[model samples]
Target: MEGFLEGIWHPLIDNEKCTNCGFCYNYCPKGVFEKNNQNIIVKNPADCVDGCHGCEWKCPGNAISFPKPITKEYVIKVIRWSKAKGRNVSKDFIKYALKNQIIQQDEVSKEMRD
Candidate 1:
């Protein structure tokens, strides 16, 4: 999951439901969220990374969204890396990823061949 992961993702706050709790601000390892005027804020959107959802889970107010989903090309790259590393991954794993919407079917074939 290193080197390259696709898609844009960041934590989004539900302001109304939010208790203005600073739990997310304190829990995030990347400091993506911060306490501003006693409210949680997305201080550094770019600092946020995909698949890192600690803040979302830690929020007592349940006021965060973990970015958009990843694309299929990204999944294929992961598959490729796993295969290249001789990991014991299933051949049908890619198909499962596509079916589950964990990855979209864009450029899957081309990337798989590489």
Candidate 2:
């Protein structure tokens, strides 16, 4: 999910495979994910570092995979471009991003609450 004019990337979680271990949330570098309830949810996917894939790697369930390959350089470049163009990002972009990636909102929010 992009934030403001910056094209920020977000994480998406697969509920079916997620073990609810919370490893991803605990290991996440940025405040990107927050766990909400039993089901993992995607709250602030934009803060996720592009191509970090830390959560996905740590997931024993193999429940995580990006819809598209994400890279830190790509995110930085897209954000820089968007800022230069002065384009305001929309919520749809975020929703769309959540469609991809291996994280969820409820888990993200739950982790935040902890």
Pick by lDDT: which candidate is best? Answer: 1
What are the per-residue Cα lDDT tens digits for candidate 2 across 20-56?
8877777777866677776556677667765355677
Q: Which stretches of candidate 2 lie over 4 Å from their true place?
A: 1-8, 70-114
lDDT for predicted candidate 1 compared with the true structure: 0.67
lDDT of 1 by residue, 16-90 (tens): 879986777777778887777777789887777654556766678777775564456556656677668776434
**Quick one: how many clashes does candidate 1 have?**
1
C-alpha lDDT of candidate 2 relative to the true structure = 0.58
**What C-alpha lDDT, on a 0 to 100 scale, does residue 66 get in candidate 2?**
66
Q: Residue 96: error of model 2 in Å? A: 25
lDDT, residue 60, candidate 2: 83
lDDT of 2 at 108: 33
lDDT for 114 in candidate 2 is 38
